[model samples]
Target chain A: MTLFDSLAIAWTALRSNLLRSILTTLGIIIGVASVIILVSVGSGARVEVEKQIASLGSNMLVVFSGSSRGMGGRSAGAGTDLPIAEGDVAAIRDKVQGVIAISGQLNGSGPVVNGNTNWTTTLSGVHPDFATVRDWPVRAGRDFTPQDIRASAKVVILGQTAVKQLFQDEDPIGATIRVKSAPFQVIGVLAPKGQSAMGRDQDDVALIPMTTARGYIVGKSQVQSDQVGQLYIKFDNSTDLKDAQEQIETLLRQRRRIQPGAEDNFNVRNLAETMKARTEVLSTMTYLLAATSVISLIVGGIGIMNIMLVSVTERTREIGLRLAVGARQRDIMRQFLVEAVTLCLIGGLIGIALGVGAAAIVANAADWPVVISPAVIALAMAAAAGTGIVFGYFPARRASGLNPIEALRSE
Target chain B: MNSVAAIIEASQVSAPVAPQSAAPALIRASGVSKIYRMGDQTVRALDDVSLEIAKGDFVAIMGASGSGKSTMMNLIGALDRPTTGHLAIDGRDIATMSSDELADLRNGTIGFVFQQFNLLPRTPALNQVILPLLYAHPRPDDLEARAHHRLEQVGLGKRTDHLPSQLSGGQQQRVAIARALINNPKILLADEPTGALDTKTSEEIMKLFGELNAEGITVIIVTHEPDIADFARRKLVFRDGKIIDDTERAPLKAATAAKDRVL
Candidate 1:
C-alpha cells in the first residue's frame, strides 16, 4: 500500500473509535509535556545562575587572609582573620603574572546618614583599582583617583541601593554622608548590580579609600594598622586561571616563610572554577529530570503498544477480511504501524503546546525563568516517533502474522 | 436426454474433469489434503480431493458443517496451502507460492465474498469497494471511477456514500459483491454467501451471482442449502472430506423484472 493510503486507512480506523484513540494518546502527551516543561525550567535556572556568576566579573579571583587550617585544626572561612595588608597586595601585583588589577578590601557594616535619612549598609574599603577588579563602574560622578587613596581622602562611592536609601532620588554625588558618625563626601554613585548567587543584595553597599577606612572609619585592625581583609584580583584573557592561582599560592607561601607541610594562612578562590562546578551540578540535575521524563515517555509507548494490541484483537475479523481481499501481510503490518505512529505524533504535537503553555504560566506566575529551544522540540518529536516504532513493532507483527482463516473465524 | 444416457455421462465424468469447452481450467486441484491436528487428534479437512473448475463456470459446493466444502473453498481462494499434493489457480502452483505471491494471486485472479457480508463498519460503500484497489500494486489510476462503476453494476451507485450500518442486509451483500468485483478477478469465490440472508435476500444475491457468471466471470459458491445450489450450473456434495455426489444441470434463469430492479 502507498504511504498515503496507509495513513488514510489508519486514520479511518482510529476515527472509528475516536474516544479510545484519544485516551490511548494521553500517556504520551503527559510524558512529552513533562519533558519539555522540566527541561526548560532546568536550563532556565542554569542560565540565570550563570548570568549571576558572570556579573561578579570575568576571570576574577578573591584572596582572603585566613589560614587554610585555623588554630586547634579547625579551618577558618574567608574574611575571618584580617591579616592581609598593602604590602601583600603590592607583592601579588608585582610578583604574579596576568594580574591586570588588584585591590585590598576591608568590609564593615554601619549606619550611613544623609541629613535625617539614615540607612544601615555595608562599607567596603578599596584601592582605586577596586572599580576595575569588581567590574563596578560609576553611574554618576567620577570614581576615586589614586591620589585620593594615597592622601587618605574622606570620599566614598555609593551603591545604587545605598544611593536610593540615603539620598531618596536626590543626587548623592559630591554630597557628604556620615558613616559611623564621620562625614565623608560621596564622590560617585555605582551602577546597579542586582543580586549575588548567594541571594544577598549586592548593591546595598558603599565603597571608600582603603587608607581612609583604616585610619578614620574602621579604627585600628586587630593584627596590624594597615591590615586589609581581602584582595580582589582581575586577570587578562590569556591567563590560565588554575596556573595563576597556583602561582599566587606559591608566592604567598614564600613571602610568609611558611614551612613545607604547614597550612598556609590564606585562601585563593577562582570564581570561574566555582561557577563551572555550579553549572555542572545544574546540568546534572537537568539530565536527571530529563531521564525521568524519558521514563514517562516509555510508559506512554507502552500505553500505545497496549492499545494497539487490543485493537488488533478487536479487529481480527477486519484484518482477515483485508487479507482475503488481497492485502498482504506487510500491508496489515503497515496499517497498524502507521496508526500507532500517528497516535504518538498527535500526542507529541499536543504535548508541545501544553508544555509551552505550562512553561509560560510557570514563568509568569512564580517568576521562574523558562527557556524552550527548537532543538528541544525537534528532539521530543523524534523521540515520540521512535517510541511509536519501538513499541508498535510487536503488535503490528502479531497482527500481520494472524492466519486468515482463524482471524476470519474470530468474533 | 434419456436417463440411462445421462447416468452413463455422469459416471464417465465422476473424477471431475475440466469441461471440453473454449474456457480453460481456472483452478486445478490434484490429490489435495488439508489435515488439522486438533489438540493431538488429527482431523482431515480435505482428503485426496481432486477437482478442476473451468473459467466462466458457475459451480456450487453443497455440504454440511465439517464436510471439507469450506476447506476446498479456502484452498481454491488461495487462503490456505494444502499439506500434500498440488493446487494451482490461474496456471500458477499456489501450494509452492510464497505468502506474498499468494496475496498477488488472490489480488489479481480471485475474489472472495464471505457469508457475513464482512463489510467494514462506518465505511461508505464506495470506499469499501475501493479497499482491494488500495492493495493493488501499480494501482489503477481510475480507482474511484472503477469503484463507482462496480457499485452501479451491483445497483448500489446511488448508495455509494451510505455506510454499512445504514444499508439493508441485501444492500450490504450487494456492496460486498461490488467490492469482490472491484479488482475484476477471473474467479469469484463466495463461501456461504447467502447464509446470513433471508430467502428473498439470498435469491437476490444468487441472482447477482448468476448475472456475474453470465458475464463470463467464473463463480463458486459453498452452501449446504440445495435451494441455493439450484442457482448454479454444477453442484458437488462433500461429506467426510470427500465429494460424495456431483451433478451438472442447466442454471436457473433469474427473472427479467428482478434483473433490472435495484434491491
Candidate 2:
C-alpha cells in the first residue's frame, strides 16, 4: 500500500474507538509533562542561585581567619591567635597586581538608639574603599571619606532597616545616633539589599569608619588591635579572582610568620565555591523529582501496551480480512504501529501545554526566574513518540503474525 | 442429434487420456492429495484426486458434508497447497510459486465469494468492492472508478454509500460478487454463494452467477443443493474425497432467459 493509504487505514482504525485511543495516550501525556515541569524547576533553581550570587558583589572575595590546622580542626571562635589586621590589608593592596580594594572589618552587636526609638543591629567598622569592594550604594547623604578614617571622625552610615526603625518617614542621613553611649553623625543611608538564600537579613546593619569605631566603640589602639573579625577583598574583574586570592594567601602567611610546612591560618572564600555548592544541591534535588515523574510515564506506557493488546483481540476479524486481501505481515504491523504512535503524539502535545502552563503558574506564585527552552520542548516530544513506538510494537507484531484462517474463524 | 452423440463419444475417448499439452489449462491437478492431521489421526481430505478445468468454462462441484469439495476448491483457488500432487493455477505450479507470487496470482486471476458473504461490517459498498482492487491496481483513481462500475453492474449503483449492515442479505451477497468482479479476475470461485439466502434471493444470486459466466468469466460454484447445481452447464459430484460422477446438464433455453433477465 501507498504511504497515504496506510495513514488512512491507521486513521480510520483509531477513529473507530475514540475513547479507547485517548485513554491509551494518557501515559505518554503525563510522562512528557512531568519531564518538562521537572527540568524547568531545576533550571529555575539554578537561575535563582545565580541571582543571589550576583546580589553578593560580582567580583568580590571574602576572607576569614582559619585554624592552624586544616578545615574542621577548629572553629573561628577557637582561633584567637590568627588575627587579620589592617596591616595585612595594606600589604596585600601593595603586593597584589589585580587588587582593586581591600578592607578589614570588625563586627559588634549593640543597641543603636535615636531619640526614644532603639533597635539592636550589627555595627561594622570598615575603610573608605569598603563601599566600592562590596557593591554598597549610598542612597542618601554621602559615604565616609579617607579623611574620616584618618582623623577618626564620629560619623556613621545607616542601613535601610536601621533607618526605617529609627527615623520612620524622616531622613536619618544627617541625624545623630548613639552606638553604646558614643554619639555619631549619620553620614549616609545605604540602599536596601533584601535577605539572602540562607535567610540572613542583609539590610539590618550600620557602617562606620574603622579608625572612629576602633577608637571609641571597640576601645582599641592601632598597635594593640585584636578584634579584626574578617577581611574583604575585591578584584578588578572576576577573571583575576584566583590570582589575587593566591597572592593574598601567600602574603598573609608570610606576614603572620608561619613557618614552612605549617597549616594555613586563614580561609579564602569566593563566589565560585558558593555557586558550585548551591548548583550541586539543586541539581540533585531536581534529578530526584524528575525520576519520580518518569515513574508515572512508565506507568502510562504500560497502559498503552495493555490497551493495544485489547485492540488486537477486538480487531481479529478485521486483521483476517486484511490478510485475505493480500496485505503483507509488515503492512499490518505498520498500520497498527502508526496508530499507536499517533495516539501518543496527541497525548504528548496536550501534556506539553499542561506542563508549560503549570510551570508558568508556579513561577508566578513563587516569583521565580524560569526559562523554557525549545530544545526541552523538542526532547519531550521525541520522548513521547518513542514511548508509543516501544510500547506499541509487541501488540502490533502479535496481530500481524496471527493465522488468517483462525482469525477469520474467531467469533 | 447425430452430431451431439459424436461429440459425446469424442469427449468420452478424450477423458480417459489426458489432453494434449499444447492448450494451456486454466487449472490442472495430478494425483492431488490433502491430508489433515488432527492430533495423532490423519484424515485424507482429498486422496490422490486429479482434475482439469479449461479456460472460459463454468463448472460446479457438488458434494455432501466432509466430501472434501471445499478442500479441492481451496487448492484450485491457490489458498492451500496440495500435499502429494502437482496443482497449478493457470500455468504456474502451486508448489513452485513463492508466497508473494501466489498472492499476485490470486490478485490478478482468482476471485472468491464465500457462503457467508464475508462483507466487512460498517463499511460502505463502494469501499468493500474497492478493497480487492487496492491489492491489484497501483492507480487509486482507476481502482475507484472500476469499483463504482462493478457495483453499478451488480445493480447496487444507488446503494454504494450504504454499509454492509444496512444492506439486505441478497444485497450483501451482490456486494461480495461486485468485490469479486472488481479485480476482473480470469476465474471466479464461489463456495455456496447463495446458501444463506431465501429461495427467491438464492435464485436471483444463481441467475447473477449464470450471467457472469455468460460474460466469458470462468465461474465455479460449490453447492450440495441439486437445484443450485442445475444452473451450471457442467457438474461434478464428490463422494468421500473423490469425484465419482461428472455430467453435463440438458440443454435448456430457459436458463439463458433467466440469466439475461437478472443481468
Candidate 3:
C-alpha cells in the first residue's frame, strides 16, 4: 500500500478515539516544551554572564596589598592594609613590559552631601590612568588631569549611582559635593556600568585624585607617606597574562625586599580566570537542566509505547480483518508506526509553539534574556520523531506477527 | 422487499456449470489433516480429508460445533495451514507458498465473508467496500467508482454513506458482500454468513450469493441450517472431522421455490 494511504488510515484510526489520542500525546508535549524553556533560560543566563564579564574589562588584574601570609602563615582578607606604595605603581608603569596602564587606589567610604541631599557611598582615590586601567570613561565633562593628582586638587568624579543619589538628575558637572565634610568640585560623571558578575552595583562609588585622598580625606592614619591600598593593572592582551603576572610577582618581591624563602605579602587576582570559572558553572547548570528534560522526554516516549500496545490489543480483530482482506505484515506494521509518529510529530509542533510562547512570557515577566534559536526547535522535532520510532517499533512488530485466524476469532 | 424481487430475477438466470474434464480444479485438498495441540491432548480437526471444488460451483458445508466445519473453512480460506498432506488453492501449493504469495492469493483469488457481518464499526459503506482495494497491487485509479458499483450490486447504492450502526442487519451483510466483491476474487468463502440473520434476510443473502455464483464465481459457505444449505447446489456434511455425506442438489429453481414458500 502507498504511504499516503497508510497515513490516511492512521489518521482515521486516531480520529475514531480522538480524546485518547490527544491524551496520549500530552506527555510528549510537556516534555518538549520544558526542554525548550529550560534551555532558553540557561542560554539567556550565559549571555547575561558574558555581558557582565565584558563590562569588568578584558585582560585585567588587581593586586591587593593585604599580607596573604599574615600570622602563622595564615592568609588575610583583601584590602586590609596599605602595603602597595606609590613607588610600586610608578615602577610597574615604567618597568613592566606587557603592562599598558597601572593605577593606585586608596579606598574609603563616607557620606556625600549635595545641597540638602546626602547619600552614603564608597570613595576611591585614583590617578588619571585609573579610567584606562578600569576601562571606564567619563560620560559628561572631562576626566581628571595629571595636574589634579600632582597638586592634590580638591576635585571629585561622580559615578552614575552616586550622581543619581546626590544630584537627582540635576547637572552635577561643575557642582561641589562635600565628602567627609571636605568640599570637592565634581569634574565628571562616569558612564553607567549596570551590575557586576557578583550582582554588585558597579556605579555606586565616587572617584577622587590620589593626592587629595592621602592628604585631606584619609591621610592621618597612613604609616608610610606614599602607601596605597591596591594597584589595578591592565595587560595588552590575554595571551601573555600568565607570563606578565609571574614577571610582576618577581619584580614586586625584589622591590619590596622579600627574601627568596619568605612568602609573598601581596595577592594578584586574575578577574578573567574568576569569570571563566563562573561561566563553566553556568554551562554545567544548563546541561543538568537539559538532562532532566531529556529524561522527561524519554518518559513521554514510554507513554506512547504503552498506549500503542493497548491499542493493538483493543483492535486485534480489526487487524485480522485487514490481514484477511489482503494486507501484508509490513502494511500493518507501517499503519501502526505511522499512527505513533503522527502523534509525536503533532505534539512536537505544538510543544515548539508553547515553548517559544513560554520563553517570551518568561523574558517579559522575569526580565531575563532568552535565546530561542532555530537549531533548538529543529532538534526537538528530530527528537520527537526518533522517540516515536524507537518506542513504537515493539508494539508495531507485535501487531504484524499476530496469527490471523486467532485474531479474527478474538472479539 | 426488493431483496425478494432481486432473488426472483437471480433465479431466472441459469448458472453454467464448469466443464469438469476441460478445466482444472479451483481448489484441491489431498489427504489433508489439521491437528491442534491443547496442552497434552492432540485433536485432529481435519482427518485426511480430500476434496475438489471447481470454478463456478456453489458448495455448503454443514456440521455442529467442534465437528471441524470451521477448521475446514479456515483451511479452504487459506487462513490456516494443514498440518500434513497438501492443500492447494488455484494451482499453487499453499505449504510451499511464501507469506506474501499467500497474501496475494487471498487478495486476488479469494474473498471472505463472516457470519457477524464484519463491517468496520463507524465506517461508511463506501469506505468499507474500498478497504480491500486499498491493498490491491497497482491499486485501481477509479477506486470510488468501483466501490460504488459494488454497493449498487448489493442493493446498497442509496446507503453507501451510512455507517454499519445505521444499517439494518441485511443491509450490513450486503455491505460486507460488496466489500468481498471489490477485489473481484474468484472464490467467495463464507463462514456461517447467515447465522446472525432472520430466515427472510438469510434467504435474501443466499439469493445474492446465487446471483454471484451465476456470474462464474466459486461460492463456498459453512452453515448448519439445512434450509441455508438448500440454496447451494452442492452440500457436504461433516462429522468428527470427516465428510460423511456429499450430495448434488437440484438446480437454482428448486431453491428459489423453497425460499418463495418461506416468504
Label model 1 with its docking quality class: medium
Q: Mind giving the per-residue lDDT tens digits that candidate 3 earns over A1-411? A: 899988888888889989988888888898889889988888888888888877877788888776755668566576555488888887887887778888888888888999899998888889888888888989899898999999999999989999999998699999998999988899999998889887878899999998888877775665367876688899887448787788788889988788998777787888878888888898898889888988988998999999999999999999999889988899999988998899899889888899999999999999888999888899999988888888899999999999999999899
Window of ten residues with lowest summed lDDT in model 1 chain B: B3-12
Tens digit of lDDT per residue, candidate 2, span A130-171? 777778788889988989988988899988988898999997
lDDT of 3: 0.85
lDDT at residue B238 of model 2 (Cα atoms): 89
Q: Model 3, B67: alpha-carbon shift in Å?
A: 3.8
Question: Which lDDT value does model 1 have at A285?
Answer: 89
- Stretches of candidate 2 exceeding 4 Å from the true structure: A51-60, A65-84, A94-266, B1-24, B250-254, B257-263
How many angstroms is residue B116 displaced in model 1 relative to the true structure, after the best TM-score fit? 0.6
Predictions ranked by TM-score, top down?
Answer: 1, 3, 2
> What lDDT tens digits, residue by residue, belong to model 1 across residues A294-349?
99999999999999999999999999999999899999999999999999999999
lDDT of 3 by residue, B128-223 (tens): 999988888868899899999999998999998999999989999999999999999989999889989998888889888877776667889999
lDDT at A47, model 3: 86
Looking at model 3, residue B188 earns an lDDT score of 98
| Backbone clash count, each prediction separately | 0, 1, 0
**Per-residue error at B117 for model 1, in Å?**
0.9
What interface RMSD does each of the candidate structures achieve? 0.7, 2.0, 0.8
Arrange candidates by DockQ, highest first: which order? 1, 3, 2
Worst 10 residues of 2 chain A by lDDT: A219-228
Model 3: residues with Cα > 4 Å off, grouped in runs: A15-26, A67-76, A94-97, A104-192, A201-229, A257-264, A346-369, B1-19, B240-242, B249-263
lDDT of 2 by residue, B21-99 (tens): 3224788899999999999999999989988876655678999989989889877877668889999788889988776
